[model samples]
Structures are given as structure tokens and as C-alpha cells.
Target: MYTDNCYSKIDNISVEYWRVGIYCRLSKEDEGTGQSESINNQREFLKKYVNDAKWTLFKIYIDDGYSGLNFERPGFQDMINDIESGLVNLIIVKDLSRLGRDYIQTGYYLEKYFPEKRVRFIAVNDCIDTFRESAANDFSPIRSVFNDMYAKDISKKVRTAFNIKRAKGQFIGSHAPFGYLKDPDNKNKIIVDEEAARIVKRIFEMYLGGMGLTTIAYTLNEEGVPNPSRYKKTVLNSSYVGRNKTMYWDATTIKWILTNPTYMGSMAQGKSEKLSYKSKKFINIPRENWQIVEGTHEPIVSKQEFETVQKMIERKNNQDFKCRKTPRLFSGFVYCGDCGSYMTYNAKRNHLYLICSTYKRFSKEFCSRHSIQEKTLISIVIEDMVQMIQKYVDVNGIKDKTVGLSFKDGKKKEIQDDIKRCRDRLEELKAMVKSLYTDKVKGIISEEDFLELNKGFTDEKNGINEKLQKLEKKLAELDRKEDEKREIEDIAKKLLEFKTLDRFILEKLIEKIEIYENAEIKIHYKFLNPDK
Candidate 1:
């Protein structure tokens, strides 16, 4: 009878060995609470508990810096996986909140899931053990609801802090936009990156030269120029340099560049906002609703260029032509002399005629139907462009005129010398500012006096700098004009190659062909009198 009692006790002891999975989670908010709230601390506590009870330790699952609001914690998922595979017969956590703060999800997993799988769930701090729960355990549901409310409160506080920073124009992002970067000293301040800024200027130049957006994108791709997104990736990762991926060009991307007011030295914000506190959805506000602050930053595109392009786009959209099936050489270029509307093309008796587009809107007598034959118009335009090109090629004539103008304008040399002196002084001031720290450290000046003196110097320097910059810009404009004259001369030298007019040549050279009443036409070519 004593041997039978020993065998029964052995069976009872074997049944008490529980295969336990320990889970731990630490949120960002709870990081500085104490070491006791840490993942390691939770693991140590559960290990002691399991060891003291002589339970079998299956695994220790941990998720660090994760939110308690969701049960999607990595550690919790791993524990669930062990349970599903029959590796764990029981789950243990430091507290009920460690499992999840979400009331519905927490209740479902505890009551339904654990029961169905025959797994014992226990929260050591909560003193809740499923194996020994009584009718008083009804209060567990209320505790879960309180935990969910705490999560909601934490989420609201985080969102409010983010909005305050955004309103202050602080860059709450990892990366800045193209052509600019966050200032190292102050993350809120945006600073120009000269190398990237040069590329941006080139893009604008190419666009102004009549290249389509797609063509410009293709050219940049061919030259191995990185797109904005790809450039950002490389800048952020030095080890991943030269690993560029091709970006597909689309109308929306091009439109983004055209519409961005940042290029105009303005800050545009609040273009999009969240729909609600609970929803992650965002809705884009209209442009009129966007908060724009002018002169907030340095501009990439000039105000004049931006405005001019806007007008050109509007004009192009308003113009209509009847020769849609066949491309008219001057479809967008021609304007009716009477109505100032775009002229439409008509083919009758194998003769193409350009007529007033406004004839349909009003009586013929209201506006004389300005009409010109296509053949005659083309002949006139071609002859006029060739003569103009020939005139541009007369280098001796140009030299004589330039010499005559120089003699007439004696004050030009003196003005240029004064501008040069101002520019040199501005450069010296900039160099001085950059090296000011060394002077201070060497005891050349006291810190207080140095700062005061530097402020006055900076004020005076800025005044001179602005004037110097204006003068330099004027000089650049003159230089560009000279370059254009030279380009015209080069084009003129190749005029002999075009013995007859063709669509390709005409489109490349001409800007417009204006047909007036009495069948009179005027040609406006690209290089004709570029100096004017």
C-alpha cells in the first residue's frame, strides 16, 4: 500500500509541470519609469515565479519600445505562435496591461482564445490566475476598459505636441526637400546647398528653353542626373552611393514643380490635414486654403520667370486651332489681327487658308475675316527669316556698330570699375565674417565687444552686399546678352545648310508667324535681333 501511494504522488507531480511562455513589452512612454518597468526586469520577475513553482520554461518573448495600446506587439505574437504550436501550455506577463490596453481585443484573447486552446493565462501583478478565478473576476473587464482609456489619452497628447512643432515651422522630418537642407545648427532653418541648387537652376533653364517636361526628364536621366527622391536616398546613405534607380516621369510630378510656391521664396503649409482624432485618413485642402508666407526663404525661381510661365500656360490653353488632324507650323503662334483670337486653318480647293477664329461668334461684318493662304504665308516667313539670318552673319557690321556705341558712351568704363570695386569689398566682408571666430579666440577682441561690433559691421556689410549683388546681376544680364549675340552669329554661319524651308527647321528657328488683314504676314524668328 505504501508503494501504491508513491506512484500516485508521482503522477500528481508530473501533471503540475506547466509549459510556460513569458511575454514582456516596453513602450516609449514608459522608458524612463524605472528599471522595474523594463523588459529585462519583467523577464527576471517571471523567471523567478516560474522557477519557484517548478514550472517548465518554454520561451521568453520580448517587444521593446512598442505601444501598449495594441496587442500587435512582436513578443505577444511570438507567445501566441508558441501556444498555437502546442509548445506553451500557459502564458505569463508582468501585468494585465502588458498583454494589451485594448479592451475588446484583450477580453477576446483572454476569455475565448485561452479557454478554447486549454491554455492558462496569468498576470502576476494583477494577481489573476485563470486556473483559480472566482465569481469576483467580473471586475477584470472594467480594468481592461480603463487601460484602453489610458492609451487614447497618450495618443492625443502625442498628436498635440506634433501640431505645435509643425505650426512653428520646425522641420519634424528626417529629410529636407531638394536644393535645400536643414541647417546643422538649427534644424528649423533651411539652408541652400550650392551643388544641388545648381542642378535646380539648370532644370529651370532647360524648361524655359521650350523643352517639354518629359524630354527634360529623359535628358537628365541620360546624363545620370539623380531625381529628387533618388538623390535623397543617396544623401541619407553614404554607403549606398552610385546605386541609382530610374524614376518614371509623369505629368503630376512636373506640375508639382511648376506649382510649388517654395521656388518663389514662400512658405506653403496646411495643404493637408487629418480628418479626425481616431482616423488616420488625411484630406488635401484647396490651394486657396493653404497658408502662404511670402519671403520666408530664398527663392529658386525668379518672380518674373514664374509669372511669365503662368501667362504663357494660360495663353496656350485659351488658343484653339481647326488643323488638329494635321500639325500647323504656327498653330499656337498665329493670332487674328481683328479679334485678337487664334486663327483657325481651313483647306478648300487644295488651298489652305488661315481665317479669323471669331467669325462663328459674331457677324462677319462685326470683324473683317482676316484670311491668308498658307503657301503665301510660308513663303513670306521663310524669305524674311533668311534675310534676318544673313544680317546677323555680318560680323564687320556688328563690330563697327559696337565701336561707335562705345565711343558715344564714355561713362561705361567708369561705372563698371565702381561696380567691380564694390563686389570685391563684399567678398572681403564675407571672408572676414567666416574667420571672425579665430580672431576672437586669439584675444583680438572681447566677446561682448566683438558681438556688438560684429552686428554693426554685419548691418553695414549687408547694405553694401545688396548693392553689390544688384550690380553683379546687371553685369550678368549684359554678359548673357553678349552670349546670345554670339549664338546668333553661330546660327547665321549655318544658314546656308537650309536651302529650302522645312517643318523641322521652321519650328526650331521661328517663334511665330503673324498674319494680318490684306494678306500681310510678319515672321518672328528666335535669333532675329537677340540684342533687342
Candidate 2:
């Protein structure tokens, strides 16, 4: 303590009056059944110390239920603002951890920020006062490092506990999935909500019953079926805020609900992981890494229905289609046969046609204008499809559009072989790396040799891993093709459904149409070899 800007007291007095800001912080980890580190207790101790020292108590700043890893607390910011404004010259806390648990920031405040502003700091319990001689002042930084480590260790233990709960099939999410509710008796258990579950079941049924995502979404919206987000917001009366205000049914939302395993009585955890204990950012984890506990709750839809819907969604996926804008029949499906380029929509006078992209860009220098009228192409498609319904296999439209054909019967086998080879190579690499480590341990190879060989193996393994990822993606495409192939007979039966071509029906059937210069159109059917 000082009076008149000097350390010595006036008239044999050892204490002086100074404005003090009492700060108290309570983290979630510190919510033990004790008043020792509670906000009120910290305030009481700091206020008593300030009062005993005859200092003026300016304000008490309390940040409750905030982590100490960051200085983003509302109370902490207010205290700093006051300090900056010269409202308080001295700061007092029950302990250093109350100041902060991050050693770097704590060290900055203790060593740089506080001193630079000519503010005296005190930790009452630790007997740390920057005024008089004490060994505690020298030990402050070390104590801060220990506090930081404590916070880190506590974070790890909490995460470990959560992982244990997940392993036990406990529901650890703050909110249950949309169609389910957390059990009133047990927070870890979930039970189906009949009201929301009906909506989930309806979405799945509509998707599997040959309805396109947009049609299903629009139908739900038209019927005033509360979408999942809205259902969560209004039905549950949730206090939690969400990203969307107007929760109309969207194709993406319907698709997510259809694909979610939670509706099928499966507990899905570890889909996303936080960046770190100190950060709120999160990233999606791969499916293989996800922890899924099957039959954990009452299913809203049958497993067979769920699996069928998954296959249907994959077959109807837009990767093989394009935009869903109505009245635009051949947006992404029309191409130029001569130049092997996509066709662009264009208008010349009153006529609408699909023109070669090459000719459209280079003015016939690259390729001739392989133009075909949209009306003509549609008539031919309807006639061919009608004919196919009678017999089942007339693919005359595969002639000109063979350029974009991505699959053949043998192509699937080749992709399967590539996948098998990648898996075998991965297993071989694992064994090789294991043997290299064994060789080092057995003294068969020197440390230098082991390091060099290990590095080489790791580099090769990483390269193989990248190839494996691409190969797996290709395998998924092949699987989708197989699914598409089996549904050809089913598709032929729906020829009448295409009589009035809507956007969804159109996207479900046609793959592409290639136009030639001679007014010929080659139409490709999805998931079918025309020659078959």
C-alpha cells in the first residue's frame, strides 16, 4: 500500500486508501458442493480484504459459469473497461485462478498489463501482494502455469467421462434428436415423441414411394406439416435459439431427416468433434469413426423401410441430375454429340433449341452446331418410353449420347477389383510398418536405417491412403449403378407416370440427351445400358 505516491506510510500508518475492483470467476468445473470458491464467497473475501486495508470498494465483477481458458467473460470485460477508464487502481481476487487459468494471458496481466497501467494486484488466499516483500510474488507465474495445467487436465477428464458415457450408449447430446425426447427419469435415455415421429415416418415413406425430395418437401409444406426445426422451436417450446426463423420444409431438411439413423432406433454419436477445450469450433468426423449403438430406443420407422429409403435417396441423388427448376427439361442433360461437349439452352427468334457448347462459344470454329429442338426431343423421348413399357428393353436413344456414358457391366467389376487391391495394399503396408518397428527393436536395423525406412513406408502409406479414398468414392458410384440397374423394370412400369412430365419425374428417369447436326437425339436412361 502507498500514500502520496510513496511506499512509506504517513505518520507511522502502514495502510492507505485506494479504489479496488473485486473480481470473482466461477467456471463450470468449479461447481463443487462447496462455498470455498463460489462467486459470493470470493466477493466476500475480496471485499473484507479491501475493507480491512481501508480501500474503497468500487465494484464487484462476477463472471459465472464461464471457462477460464479465455478472457471473453462479460464481467471480466467490464472490469477491464473500468480499469482502463481509471475507475479503479487496484485489483483483488480470492486466488490467481480466479484471475484466469490461461498462464500466458495470466502472465501478461500480472507482469505487463497491470503494471503498465500502474494498477496494484493482490491474490488474498495466496498472500500475493505486489506492494511489499514476499516470496509469493516470485512464485506467481509458476502457480499460474499449474492453474493452466489444472484446467487442461480437468478438460481431459471431462471429455473422458463423456466418452465413457457414449460407450455405454448414453445420450450425451444437449437435446435429443427431433423425433425423440430425453427420458424424464434418465437424461441418458431417449423415448419416441409420437407427434414428431409421425412426421419423420411420413417423410421416409414419401421418399421410398417414388416421390422426389422437392415434391415431398412441397407436399409437406402445403399440408402445413411443421418442419423439424419449427417443430423443435414451437412444439417443444425450446429456449434454445436456432439458425432458421421461418422453418418451411426444404429438400435438404427432409433428406437429413430421412437419412438420420436416430429415427431407426440407433444412437449416433461422435459425428462431430470440437476443435479443442479452449475453442468452440467443431468439424465433422468420418462415418467409420462414428459410434453407433443400434436398437437404443423405439424406432419411428422400420429398419427395412429406413434401408429402402436410403437406397432410394442414393438412386435419386442429384449427383447424376441437375437443377430442379420447373419447365426447364434439359438444363444439364443435353449435350453435343459431335464435339463431346455439353449443350446450352438458347433462343434464336421464336425457336428454342439445345445448341452445342463448343459452337456456342467458338462460333462453329471448334465444332458444328449440333442443335435439336426441345419439343422434338421431348416427343421422341415420350414415344420411346411408351414403346419400352410394352416390351421392357428398347434403348434406341443410346446412339449419339455415348460420350457421357460413365458405366458398363464390366466397369463395375474393374472398380471392385481396384477397391480390393487398395484394401490389400493397405494391409500390406500396415504389416511392413509393424515389421520395420520390430526390426529396430530386435537390433536388426540401425536407428538411422529404421528412421529412413519408417519415413519411406509412412510416405507410401499416405499416398496409398489418398488413392484408397478416391477408390472408395468410385465404389460408392458403382454400388449406386447396381441399385439403378435393378430398378429398370420398376421404372418401365411407370412409363405412364412420365405422360405429364414434372421436374421430379423428369430428373428421376432421364440421364442426358446428345444432339447431332442431323437433328438426331440420343437420350440416355439412368441406371441402364441401352444395348441391354
Candidate 3:
């Protein structure tokens, strides 16, 4: 009876042929482990075992240098595809850990997947074979729990190492920002390339010259200055560069360059961080949490110029009033005398009138209407403008007086010298920091001492930075005054040919008009200076 039963079992095993696939995984984190766990070793062992057992060697799937914490692996998916296509009836791996470290996924495959498909699964190192077992006999669940613990330990170690690097102010990102290149000698350092750096400087200068972000962007495109992403791709040979080829200007790109502190040689990091190891989401941290290392690289823009642009943007953004209506020949030129507010246009009964905008918006109790006939105001402005224009033409001296020179040659030289000196000092400090880092790496200086000295140098560097900022501001002020003089001179020369005032001339010349409570008016003209 025993011999007959054994023969029946052998017949049952021969009913299906086993086509086996080898799975191999090697994580970068596990590089230091024994060679037995290496991908090559796993492949070799699986091949030899399959050949000796007379099983059909179907294929090998490998996920090299990948973490086993998740089952979102490419090779693993390919093996699953083979199973669904009836090409592979059995799966083989060197160990259970190679399959995956996620316990839930491992258990799902072992308990449910293999049985439903009549697929055999085997882990050689763990001595677990699914083909000879009932559902209750499988020990994969216990093995998966251990694999998960291994993954958790690896994650903790990685986090600790990252914290240490961050504290040292080393650049740990895979890619640097636009206009900077990672130093070849030191991966943690960044150096500016002159060609790209010049482009960055031009962008900043255009922004400070009163150009709107969109307008500046359009000008850049027209001038054929390569956009940031395209420039990076050309220089770095990166395949991941932005491929948008429409060549249209975008305001967001201009705004990003204007706001980035990196252009000032400061490093700002930790803007966003991962929520957890399991979650792929990131959350932004507060600015206070940012790790900033100043004077870490070469600067393309001065701190003062950056600050000036920021202040200009803030002023415009927070303005309380909106002046949408275009000024007529004398609409904005007139103001109310009593309330000291702008004289706004009011049309009634086929006649135009000027009234105090502030008084009308608030209430009669606040101020008087300060009304005046628009025709009278227009007639008066036309007479004054014509007289001014004629005077400019007659004497040939209005250009010089109206376009007054404000910058002294000696002051400009002094400001330039001050800026040069500060920059020289900054470069010297950077060289010293680099030397100190070399010493620390060679064990000539202890880590603690290096940090202390670095902090001291940083403080001194910041002080010099403040001085440099003051000098740059003085330079910008001088430049603005010079531009104003030139603009007024040009406008005076143009106005000499005009016979009478028109809407186009009025729009170009006047900014606004304020009216007071007594019907007196004041005109504020557009500053001729581009810097203004």
C-alpha cells in the first residue's frame, strides 16, 4: 500500500511543469554587506540551482542599487508580467529580503497570489518553498516582519548622515540652481561661470531700472538671452532640462530670478522637507528654519540693488489707490486747493468737471468737493505747456536747466573703490574657508574647532557685506541722477518741435494731479529717469 501511494504522489507532481524565473536585488545601502547578498552572486546561485534541479530557466529580473522598502520596482513588475502571461510558473530569489521589505506586499504575494495562480515561490536562503505547503504552513509573514525592521534601521542611519552633512553647510543637492555650477574638485562647493553670470547680472539691472517683470522678460526673449532652463541644459548636458520650446516670455521666471538670494552669494536651503519615510509628500518650513550660509559662492548682483528692487515691488503692491483712467490734456494736471487731494474727472449734463477724488470717495463731512470746469483747466494747461515748449526752443538752455546733473565725478570714483575693496576682502575670506576645510578633511584640525573658526569668519564676512551694500547703494543713487539728467535733456529737445498739446503728449508727460478743498491744483509729472 505504501509503494502504491508514493507512485501516485510522483504522478501528481509530474502533472505540471515548473518554469522558473530568478529575481535579484542589490541596494546601495547594502554595498558593504557580504558578497553572498550581491546581485551577481544571487543570479549565479539561482542559475546553478535551477539547472541542477532540471527546472526550465526562463529569465532573470534585477533591481540593482534600489531600496527594497517598496514594491514599486521595475524588474519586479516585469516578473509579474511574465507570470500573468503563463511564461513563468515559479519564481526564485536568493532570499526573502530580495523580494521586498514591505511586509504587507510580501504577505499578499505569498498567501494569496501563488495559490490562486498555482505558482511556486521559493527563497533559497530562508529555506521556504511554497509548492510543498498548504496556506497554514507558509512562514513568509514572519520573515517579512524582519525584513521591514531592516528597512527601518537603514532609513534611520541615512537620516542621521544627512543631518551631519547639513550642519556642515555642504551642498547636498543633486543639481545646482541656474547660473551656478557645482565645483568639480569639491562636490559640496558651487562656483559661478562668467558667461552665465553676466546674463544674471543683466536681468537684475533691467529689473532695477523700473522695468515690469513681464516687460523685462519680453525684452530678454527679444534680445536672444537664453532662458534659465535652456541655458542650463546647453551647459550641463542634462537630459532633464525643461523642453518647452514656444519661446514666449513668462513673468514667473523673471520674478524667480529677482527674488533668489543665491545671486547675492548666499545659500538658502531646507525650503521644503519630506513628511516621512513612507509618504512622498513634502511640506514647506518657515523661513526661520532655513539653513543660510552667506558668502559661500561668487555673487552676480549686489545686495543693495536687490534690496532696492524689493522695496519698489513692496511699495507698488501695497498702494491704496488705483489710477485706471487715462489723464486728459489737463485732467490729472489740476488739483483741489482746500482738501489737498487729487482732482478727479466728473462728467454731468454733457459738460466735464473736476472734483476732489478723496472728498467724493470719503464723505462731504471730510472735505469739500473742490469743483472746477474741465474746459478752463485745459485752456490754462495748454497755454502754460506752449509757453514752456517755446521757451525751450528759443533759448536752447531749457534742456540744461530742466535736465540737471546730480552726480559728482569724484563721488562716483569713491563709491567704485569702496565696492572693489569689499569684494576683494570677501574673496580672501572664501579662500581661507576653503583652506580650513582642507585641514579638517586631512585631520589637521578637529571638527569642533573648524566649526568655531567657520562661525567667526562668517560673522566678519557679514560685517564686510553690510559695508559693501552701503557702497553699492551710493553708486545706484549716482546712476539714477545721471539717467534723470539725460532723460530731461532728450525730452526738452523733443518738446521744442511741438506746436500744440495732444492726448499722446499729455499721457507721456503727466503722472497725476491732486486737488485740494479750495479748488487749487498741483501736477506731478512722470520722472524722466528710467531708474526712478
Q: Quick one: best lDDT, which candidate?
A: 2
Question: How well does model 1 score by local distance difference test?
Answer: 0.68
lDDT of 2 by residue, 214-288 (tens): 568767766778876788878898865433345676666777788888888888898898898778899999978
RMSD of 1: 28.1
State TM-scores per candidate.
0.48, 0.57, 0.54
Q: Once superposed on the true structure, which residue ranges of model 3 sit more than 4 Å away at CA?
A: 1-16, 32-36, 134-137, 241-249, 303-532
Better of 1 and 2 by lDDT: 2
Tell me the whole-model lDDT of each prediction, alpha carbons only.
0.68, 0.77, 0.73
Per-residue lDDT tens digits for candidate 3, residues 69-108, read 7678899999999999999988998889898888888888
Clash tally, candidates in order: 0, 0, 18
Model 2 Cα displacement at 468 (Å)?
Answer: 56
Candidates 1 and 3: which is better by TM-score?
3
Q: Rank the candidates by TM-score, best first.
A: 2, 3, 1
Candidate structures ordered by lDDT, highest first: 2, 3, 1
